[model samples]
Target: MHDDGHGPGPARRQDQGAARHEHGHSHHRAHSPSHEGARAAGRLRHRLAHLLTPHSHESADRLDPALEASARGLRALWVSLAVLGATAAVQAVVVVLSGSVALLGDTVHNTADALTAVPLGIAFLLGRRAANRRFTYGYGRAEDLAGLAIVLTIGASAAFAGWTAFERLLSPRPVEHVPAVAVAALVGFAGNEWVARYRIRVGRSIGSAALVADGLHARTDGFTSLAVLAGAGGSALGWQAADPVVGLAITAAIALMLRDAAREVLRRVMDAVDPALVDRAERALSAVEGVHGVGELRLRWIGHRLRAEVAVVVDGEATVRQAHAIAVDAEHALLHAVPRLTAALVHADPAPVAGQADPHLALAHHARV
Candidate 1:
């Protein structure tokens, strides 16, 4: 409920004073940093500036936010894919040496993962291209398409794995060189865990949701690797059917993840904003002083960031300059509250209206031309 620009900490009092002055009159007053509250706000801004300095260049590119997101996503995908390829080659060798059906299935899955890297990498690089007349939104959605393809590839791999496991389960076979299978699985587990950790860290730092999703995918594989290891170990202990059962379990897990990813990618492609995020944005906007209310709050996801457009109702008695300043303050406050917000359009309303008040209707009425 607090309407302070610097957040709801001790800075509320100073912010309230500034808001009162800004809303009451057109007089400009220099902000004095003496208030503990003002100093706290200054510090927060400084820290945020430092954290976002690297992204500044990307933000300035004039390229669509989605495109920038794709570039970062592809870079992460390429690196993870390379690691997967190397792991798959090693896994294939182990499969051949141990003659383990489970190991072979894992090798195939890894190869499938590596194959997805090709399209994902291409999509990232191509998605960043400047928008042509034919594609005004640029190729940002290419990344979402690429993500959908990756999910499909994973689903297919999982299905194949399940089929292979079912066959192995029906007709059990003796696995050769159980020790070798175990060793290979252990190596794979360690390698995948490392890759997953690195990818997750980098993905978060870059604010690339696709990369974060991919990292989660890699981490799931790591868990699968552990499952494979357990099966191979069990097979060594006279439980020959354990390997196939574990494979089926892994396949099921992958299928579930694929389903979730598919839903997320579809939503992204359709530009759906998270309902929770929309609600949070509404709260932030409504909290700004001089804003009697908020309406027509529309939010869209552009890659990892959000684009928002809202109407802010101010007192009808306020001057045009006062209303514009209130709108500007609301813009700043909303962006500060929502870091992922790339841009916002704040339409100022003369008074609060209820029951289907169209902000755009107000705009049409106020046009000078």
Candidate 2:
């Protein structure tokens, strides 16, 4: 589980060979040349496709190297902050020149987006702390808390945008210097799109839900900027109410973004993972030599890293040492098969015989608790 790379190493192969020999299972069917070739090809295809696809928070696997995920997350926040800050500055200048209320609100929105990086950056720093007796899991949950903050920020942005648009609708204002406003809107869109793509890519690579949510927020801001640009065009044609109407539409869009962001963060908080990952883990466990069946498998994310707890059924007559070897082999298979899986705890259970008592009943009370 602590290996530096994904594939099985020399030590792992040795252990697997020993376990397979002890179990007396033939390697012919499972380890044929064609089967190994297919598996390798499948892994390569997955890696290539993973680079382009933006997986959901539940579905994405962490790709950063050991102890480097937090560093990457922090880098993404700083870069996003810088880009968004400059974008807001340019929009602010246009706000003053045009006296356009809609443009001014967008500038403020962009500024707020830039400031969001502060909480996420702090969370990334906190995630790097080593575990102690008091916090056995370390401060990884801080990243989840940061994700909540980002969700709240998105909610606030939606509310503010809606209110501004409502007020403007009540008292429509003439937007002056339409040309300047249009140019600023384009600048805002370009800056936000770039930041969005960067943050999302890094976030997926590191499996940081907070970072991805922040990226989605930036995308919403980009759409808002485009809405402003559209309004500016309408104003140039002497339509005074166009800005507020477009602002209202942007607010609706923000609401949708808020929903998706909230769902991802809440799922993370709830320890929800994609069922496909669970199936993959089960298959890995079942393939381990001497494992009769996979009893139970559980995977959860702790701050961008994955940990597993599993139970595997082995021969009822096997001694403790043989069972332990089987468990070790199962753990090794899991680490190789599942991406971002840093640790696994495997429990070996004896397979039931026809008339034997249930071994699991010894822990029935614990399960109820």
Candidate 3:
């Protein structure tokens, strides 16, 4: 072979030098305008990701809305118990002095109402316990049980109020110091109304129907207390029958409250969640980028928290990965759409064509907190 001017070593070194030069050129090309534009897009996507997702640091105390609601509910219970205790104490003193059956009945109910908070507070605390193997949904149903207990208590109160008032009406007795009874009645009204408004406001804000019902009970009790004041006024005007008559009226009022509380308790027990929440979930699923339809959306309350099961329809041409992404989007949207929703399970299916059976039709859809 003829000797070339460049030996084997020189040729190998030259090849290496050319490869290094080409690599440098390619690296430099990576920073060109188009490449920088792609980098900018990558950076924008990363930033958008941060904005779209929740931050761990935002929950510094790790207190979510449901947890905060439970905490606030406990606080409200304690405060109302204190207020009603004070009110009932004053009324009990008046009851002893004046021997007014109406005031005594009111005092009893106010005390019972205050005590009802105990079961509810216990329920709220129980609801905080994590789910177990036997109770996959946790102890939230305890709230419904607490609600039932409250209904029973109120019913018993009404029966007692009615019986006592009827007995008093049968045997007339003069109520002494009518003015003291009236003052106690007024105190009862003020305290109960305050508690009612506080509980209702807080309960509604926290999406706690049980608490709202309890608040309504307090409101009804306030009106009954007002009836007691009317009785005192009637007794002062020499209409002795007015005291028993007012007590009977309070019993009737309490009957009405019992009906309301019973209905609320029954609804919760039957898993009759608000229809508006269902509508909101459907709307959110429909709005997702690849979701073409929403079907079989179910929502329910376990304790105070909400849970949803939603079926979403995506394009038939979508790959499994694409369908998964759509389902995830639907899940996220549903969570934000419904208040107090703690969990959501989204099922994605292909959009059905004409004469084609829907894929999600036969699937089991169930929701529980």
Candidate 4:
């Protein structure tokens, strides 16, 4: 829906006095870079104010929200790639002018961050593909594989930064152009921090853990970028070891990012989701009028979005039409309850007696231990 950031949406506008379930997400047409830039600025500003608010529902929900979000995410990746690429290019020039290994390490890390946008962008683009026989769930899982690649990139960056740092430690060298190095370091910090904030903001909105982790990576790179300044400062102080020591510190910081990135990527691979999100889904299922109780509820990440399988108990005497209606309502409710829930499979089963056997329960399920 078009959100000009003025007031309530059409659904909320119907009854502005009361809180309502948001049935739709918001987006505005970006006619130009200034338009998108202003939106981003406004997003950060109004984030806290609209933290608990959901998108208002529209009369006709034509496009898939999940696909739209993926498209937006791809655009964000493209912009970040451009910003970081330019930042890295500027630093690379500085690295040639002033041979500071710490600056070099930071530059390498930023370059890798820019390169990472390629895989993730590919993943987002591929995620928009319709499901096929060979890949029934589409290529969403490619995002996870891309996340793995990101983790590998982080590790490789750490190794290179660490090695260069140690090599410099062993053979200390003079750092040239003290003022220029500091200026480049500041440029690096500004670029990375901006990209970090942008990525993290978009990632959270899109519910992409990998994107969020990558944002954190950019932030770490920002801080490491500052370390170059410390090295320049040391060199000015006639402390030759300061540059290498700072380089070592930058490596250590990257190692920390590697750990966090690995944790998030592995969790995606293992198909773990927040327990609270599952509980919200269960509550949504229970809210259905004909649903007697919520049974099995399973959720998994297909890239940034969630897919769910829910089993609901209904009155044994209900007609198939009634049951189908209940399932549809329950699915809609669950989708509204949990943000980023793209699809849900709801099974309507006859209500069982107390302590009675249900064959479905006896079968192996993803939920049971």
Candidate 5:
């Protein structure tokens, strides 16, 4: 027996439970206030922890959290793009005035980082499309492709920055308008830092690996912007080679960002999710009434939402109707316990009986094939 968790399955059971609880409500009325208070306190703690260190998939209670998340992701992308664009524009003017290679490298990277939002925005839009016959899983994977594009863009920017820095190192030149370079670098740092925090918060809340990777990229740019300030200080002290050296350092930072972003995107493409989520699913399934055992359980991301497939063991003597009821209960438990979970498929299996042939034995040869 199987349950898809979208239909109204076993509503009679829920109503009966409510009725029973209401009949016995007077017996537990004295403790209800404390229990409610404890639950509220727990929720507050979890909320605070989530804000302090955001994870990939946080719990949401919206009817269509996926759609809400997508809208938030798009808004974050456009706002971040505008912020970084302005930062880069200001640094570009400073680069022209001071001719600081370090500032130039930072500007280039900031511009590229800002433009990354374009492909990501497109991917978010694509993700909203309904699934078709050919693409049964929908266009969610487009975000992964956008993440690949971001990684490549980061790589290209790093290469260009490295090359420019090398050329400047070979032919040393004075960096003029040192004070202006310092001011521009500070501006870049502030802007990138704000955008990084914004993107990361929204990305984590929405469970978008690509958006988080982009946020990390912006964070690296912020630090590199600070490095530009060091070069400005050196140029003021008559160290003509300092600007190129700092530019090279910025390139190395971008390379590191590229490595990290590539790894995250690759993991998403591989359908990797946090192991703790699997553990939680197992616990939830085991807790469901009438579930004798939890068999194999699997979870994978379809865009920011999660889908689950799990097998649960029930009494072999139970009727088909009873087994199916257990499956529906298991599915409901799973959907409630797993954060970001939009759907679940629960399969009920009969437990083994002594002297009985294995029910799946007939299909063993097919499994091998």
Candidate 6:
């Protein structure tokens, strides 16, 4: 009895073997071509990564040049202040001998500028120190504070000088030793110009806001010295009133500079990154091939460099591993584009599609609904 229910026949066995062979062939045909292509692409990517990875470290090392430039600017400030202090003392004696209120007030302003330099030098030194627990962002802001202090001091000096000049304008006074004052003003102008050039070069090279502020102050002083020379020349020619008039002009110029300095310091303290800079950052992130969109871009100034955080959307069809790799590549591209970026945090989001129920799109609809 061929248990009519189930019995293996030669024909049935041959049919099963043919079915197994067809199934295996279909599986090989489905995966083989794509697998080879993927493998080849991966090998190319590995070679590229090896070549590009070292460049990131090299770019990081370039930051040292900026730090060194800042250091040089600080040293220049100290030296310039020392020389100005000595000149102030000499001018004080000359002003006292001449009994010229304009000369005396200018000398006083120089002395105040000299005093500001002392604290600024200290702040620069401290700012360069390694970060401690007390200051997670480091002492870099000390330089900003020093800049504010210097501007305030200069502003106050300018106000006082203006007041003194006004009094002299109301009642003109005879000035003696006009030749000596003129000579001194010329020397001071030359000295200030020298320091201003040095500070500007270093500040721009390092992107140090404090150094730039100091350089501006020096340049203002150089212009004031020119005003002083004109006053001395007028006094020698018996135009005693020119001393106060030139003093008033110098005070006006100083006030303008103080306004600008205050604006810059406040911007830094408030972490206000320029809109242009933000746009640049967005462009840099979007340049990455796999990044579909960018959002929640935020940036803040950390001393000379910028700290940024952004959200990037990538192809939703990609595997989890691919999304992660794309995110890393986007980050690398951003750093390369903006060399001054100190740190960046990137969030990877899945891209949205027309018919699919994307979580991000759903959340947006819910908010609108």
Positional deviation of residue 257's Cα in model 1 after best superposition, in angstroms: 2.6
Indicate which candidate wins on lDDT: 5
lDDT: the better of candidates 3 and 5: 5
Model 1: CA > 4 A from native: 1-72, 132-134, 270-276, 287-289, 317-325, 352-369
Off by over 4 Å in 2: 1-64
Q: What C-alpha lDDT do the candidate models reach, one value each?
A: 0.69, 0.80, 0.80, 0.80, 0.83, 0.70
Best-matching candidate per TM-score: 5
Q: Write the per-residue lDDT of candidate 6 for residues 1-369, one digit (tens) a residue.
A: 011112245356334423421211111212246744774686598569879865433322544644665577677778878877887878788877786666666677678766777767777677666555677656667777887787788888988989988998999987888888887677667766777787777766766676677778777777888888889889988997988888888888788878877787778778887798788878988877667899788887656556677888866555444555566566666666775665566667766668856555446756753
User: Which segments of candidate 4 are over 4 A away from where they belong?
Assistant: 1-63, 354-369
Per-residue accuracy of model 5 over 133-233 as CA lDDT, tens digit each = 78766788899999999999999999999999999999999999999999999999999999999999999998999999999999999999999999999
Per-residue lDDT of candidate 1, residues 1-369 (tens digit): 122121234355334433542323344333233533554575577569869874431234423544555665666677778788888888889888876777777777777866877876776676556556787445656667777777888888988989998999999887888888887777677666777787678656655455555666676777777888888888888998998988888888788777776776777777776688778888888877668888788877544556678877876556555566567667767776775675566777657346745535646967798
Q: lDDT for model 1, please.
A: 0.69
- Candidate 4 achieves a global lDDT of 0.80
Candidate 3 residue-wise lDDT at 44: 76
| Candidate with more favorable, higher TM-score: 5 or 6 | 5
- The Cα error of candidate 3 at residue 49, in Å, is 8.3
lDDT string for model 4 (157-234, tens) is: 989989998999999989999899999999999999999999999999988887888899999999998999999999
| Model 3: colliding residue pairs | none
Report the C-alpha lDDT of model 2 over 165-245, residue by residue, as the tens digit: 889889998898899999999999999999999999999998888899999889989988999999999888988898888
Per-model TM-score versus the true fold: 0.72, 0.82, 0.82, 0.80, 0.83, 0.77
lDDT: worst 10-residue window of model 5? 20-29
